[model samples]
Target: MAAAASPDRAHRLLVVAMDFDFYRQAHSDLTYADIDPAGHYGAAGWREGRDPAPWFSTDAYLEQNPDVAQAGVNPFVHYLRSGYREGRAISRSQFADAYYAALANGDVPITAAERSAAAEHFDARFYQTMNPDLAKVGIDPLDHFLRHGWREGRDPSFEFSVADYLELNPDVSASGVHPFVHYVMTGRHERRPLKLDLTFRQAALGRLQSFEGRLADARRWARPIELTQLGVLAEALANAPARGLHLTFSHDDYSRSVGGSQLCVQREAAEFARLGVNHLHVFPANGWPTVRSGATRTPMGVLLNGETVGSFVPHDITRALKSYHAEGPRSFAIHQMLGHSSRDVVDIVRAAGMNAGYFWLHDMGSLCAGVHLMRNDVESCGAPPPQSAACGVCIYGAARSGQLREHELLFSRLDLTVIAPSQVALDTWREGSDFGAREALVLPHATLVPSDEPPPMRDGPLRIAFPGTPSIHKGWPVFNHLANRFAADPRYEFFHLASKPATGTTARHHHVAVTVDQPLAMRQAMIDLSIDVALVWSLWLETFCFVAYEAAAAGAAVVTSPESGNVAAFAADSGHGLVLRDEQALEALFESGEILQLSRSVRRPGLFDLKFSRLAAELAPA
Candidate 1:
């Protein structure tokens, strides 16, 4: 519908575009020939986004360029006639001016720098005309463009980021809050209900935070409330070893300075019992001393990682555990002859008219003076830990305090049967005790900590964990030795799952807080942190090292000692552990890197099922 152009004419327009570009360069050092002619493109010439339907069209050329258009010279006929008549010559400066004018007319495809200058002039006029804040802020009139002005979009590659834009326009940025947020705060962005106001939003966010805090607090409280009924507890205590077995510990479930023995007993026993496949019961109510009303010392508060969480009276912890699970102990087993007496203790059980007395042991304390006398490592009975005097010191001390002759006279009156887990425990018992375990079933009564998250894959420093109380007897000395010995190595990291909070720190290792308050949290944390290996470095023979099993359950490699008790035997039998002899071997083991492979080979040992079933059979009459 418009004039057509010759090939030669089209070629001439290409040169014209180059001239326009030259002008855009401020006519600085560059010539018309210096710019690429094809840089400005479209169906004809106008601009890239222009319609091609015109096909060399323009306004009535006859009125503006009669001769040039009448000759059918084609594209931009009117412009050619006006700017360059048949005999007239056009200069680059004249063309650059025309191109600049077209940019101001809202045409696209203008040079980027020319476009920016034109946009600034237009933005200032638009802001002055439309914005009310122009007078109050006293900022440059051009500074107010909500999101866009004449230049509504840009190529990201060429545009400056918001931060850079702010850097270049600090005056604009200093005017107020971020522009988008300010629009909302000023109520100019949208109309909203009362709930959307700043005050309401803040209040809602505060409530959400409070809810989360209460949830975490609830998670941190280990004591039971009214959730589970007491009937379950009576059922549990009446028929314990009705399935599984664990003994009374020195502290409640809260003490990591020892272990979560009571928690372990309650949880594992409840599980087996719920399964209804094999029998299960926690010994003497899942804690030590078969806690009667006054069998224990003052119910001490439990301190973990050095924070006092709560306190318990004698047997109150067990009461809570049973209440928590809606379960109770079915029977009572005395662990170690160390912390017992036939009168007040036995009378406490028989007072309930319970005659099924079960004795349990990892040591032959009944035959020897001290329960902790390491094999071939004693001349006379050694002293107990200063914290606890019941380790054969109070009631069964062979040579030091309580005379065995006096104990033997008292022991003849009660009915008791001793139980052992491993051949090692049985053999040691035989060497020291006059009466052997009525049943020797190689089962650690406390099941492994229930598995939660998968272990993390790691490739950096050796991450080692000591997973029991940091008690001197449980091997705090060895832990300190390792910490000091590896102080300078960047390739090793040590973590102690301490009961007490961190009092002080050494640069060698970190103290991880593993508490009874949140067993599942502890398990998940272990997996999350990629704790690599668990050290079974106890100085004494553990009746059953629940710590070793717990660490394995949490996905760490077990590096137990090749010493007495179930810790050594289980580590050896698993074939996935690094059984080192002593502290001297730690570095060598670390350097060996066998733990990396051993970590992958962990297998959960049969917890209390085998031992409990065997005990049940033994308890039955032929």
Candidate 2:
């Protein structure tokens, strides 16, 4: 029985004999070999020593295996046997007889005519017993028998009488019914048992369990508030003697990198959670961790489908949120209330049931081209725009042009509070939009002043340094013109600190020295070279010039254009810098010994010291 159960056992005996006999029969037909005593009698060889007897007997050995005679028993049978136990043969007729008997006894409650028709159907099974191959391939031999076995004037398509169905299945209408009707109603086909190996099955089950556990844990950690800024949120939670503050950091410009900005943000966020800051607003676009405020990360729920659904696939958002929330944030803050894309982001946050806040970046109205005070199609920092029109042009243009409706919608929809990086930015907002002047607060840009001692001055021609990339708008042309004019005189020297050599005809100028693209090395060289004056000649309205700050911190007298927005503010406050509107004013300073005095005063504590305190205060918790 065990040998019969294996497909390999049948294959080995059957395959060997079948091949031997087929070749032997072919060899015999090709020659006249009725009887040869030495066993070789063919056209190719009739020699006495050569023999065909061994092959003939090997063929006979193949015909003797009993397993071959049992035609119905094959590998497929053994496959079925692995799942089903052997039992007494339930002949088709006997099964039908019981079926009808149960129907008649009210165990199966079908009509009398149905029972008679079913009995006729039961008689058809005898045909399938005669031809088992038909049954093996899923053809119902009994149905074939009933229609054409004896050709008893019956059409194959004739509808089955109700009596026929009831008669074939004896317990068809019985209260204790078989599973047939239920299976038929559900359209379910019988499936073979799965045969996964033990290790694989265990692994699949474990993965399913882990998925369920993570979902359960996420549900338990859901929060109700939303605060965006990490530091503010952390502080609020720490000082939450009354209620937890939902804080969020929404301004993109404020969330920039300093020496250790990322680390500071992360550490502060963790501290906030420890102090009970439950809500954190994370902007994934900025690469901030999503769930730093709380233990659970929530999605920004926006309805994204059809054409509106961009490359921002749901799977991507889900993965990002899960990774972020896994960091164990206490809460979330959703941001950017002024643009269409931001609105989409907010929608996603809201869908996750997260609290959201609107964050304003810059005054969209005055910044846009239409309302901007233009000079030859260019806007300069001559005078500020009116309060009402400041953000109007940009906002209207964005809506009209369909450029950033999503961002504009975010600004339109959310309950927003404006946070500005500088007092100037806040003032610009007040004069520009209906959002009201008081709605904005001055959150100045944070800074870090290096604590190196002022080195002694060296005797040499004053090194007037320009520390950034020389672009046209950054007054590179102005510097080029100054260097060309000064190269004619040997008294004053000029140095261009940049990544590449100065391009064009200006490269010929002797005073124009290039330090080529080394930022760290160039900065240190400036200190060692004892640079007297740092020239910042920007033609554009800069919000803040970081190079100016760095040079001032290095104890260099700064000479910048008055139009360089915050440069004037720094010069007025620090006394460590000078602002000049025209070349003549700069020339007067250079000639009157004022430049020398300015360089000497640059290292004074009152000038550079105040800058350090201002920076430290800006970075401190509000």
Q: Top TM-score: which candidate number?
A: 1
Cα lDDT computed for each candidate against the true fold: 0.43, 0.40
Query: Could you tell me the lDDT of residue 19 within candidate 2?
Result: 29
Task: Tell how far residue 490 is off in model 1, in angstroms.
Answer: 2.2
In candidate 2, what are the lDDT values of residues 413-434, reduced to their tens digit?
Answer: 5555565545655554455445
Angstrom error at residue 225, model 1: 26
RMSD of each: 25.8, 32.7
- Once model 2 is optimally superposed onto the true structure by TM-score, how far is the C-alpha of residue 203 displaced, in angstroms? 70
TM-score of each: 0.42, 0.41
| Candidate 1 Cα errors over 4 Å, as ranges | 1-261, 264-331, 336-340, 362-369, 374-411, 436-442, 446-454, 502-523, 590-622
Worst 10 residues of 1 by lDDT: 152-161
